[model samples]
Target: MNWILLIIAGLFEVGFATCLGKAKEATGNSALFWMIGFFVCLSISMFLLYRATLTLPIGTAYAVWTGIGAVGTVLVGVFIFKEPATFWRIFFLTTLIGSIAGLKFVSN
Candidate 1:
């Protein structure tokens, strides 16, 4: 259950990051809304991360959380922002995802 929360938190991390990017590109009232979303998502992500740390090893939780966020963010960038999805980038992202899964599998 904790791991599940952690994963959801990681997804929220991706949400916040994407919101930040949109906020950066936005103007006037649009930027305000995106900024609000960024803060809300960030708060939820951090809170869930902290909650997971109560039961899970902090180091493992944090690493996995960040790994999920990083990979998810890269995917969102490629698909939504039309960022380059070069072979090497996809390869590295896949490697990171594998590492994240390995961590989850090895954790107590």
Candidate 2:
């Protein structure tokens, strides 16, 4: 259950980051909405992450949470926002995923 919460929190982290990015490009009411959403999601995600860390190992929890959020955010930036998805960018993402998986296994 804690792991599930952690994953959900990670997803929210991605959501907040994407929202913040969009907010940066927005104007007026739309910008305010995006900004609010970003902060709310970010706050919730952090709280959930804290809860998860109480039961899960700190290193493992933080690694998985941050890893998923970062990878998801970059993918969102590339696919949704049409940001650069260069070869080097992909290479590092793959490396990060692999390292996170390795860490998970070792921690388990």
**Candidate that would win on TM-score:** 1
* Alpha-carbon local distance difference test for all models: 0.96, 0.94
Deviation (Å) of 42 in candidate 1:
0.4
Residue-level error in angstroms, candidate 1, position 25: 1.3
lDDT of 2 by residue, 1-108 (tens): 888898899999999999999999999999999999999999999999999999999989999999999999999999999999899999999999998788777874
TM-score of each: 0.98, 0.94
lDDT of each residue in 1-108, candidate 1, tens digit only: 999999999999999999999999999999999999999999999999999999999999999999999999999999989999999999999899899999998999
Candidate 1, TM-score vs. the true structure? 0.98
lDDT of model 2, residue 49: 99
Worst 10 residues of 2 by lDDT: 99-108
lDDT, candidate 2, residue 85?
Answer: 88
Task: Name the lDDT value of residue 101 in candidate 1.
Answer: 93
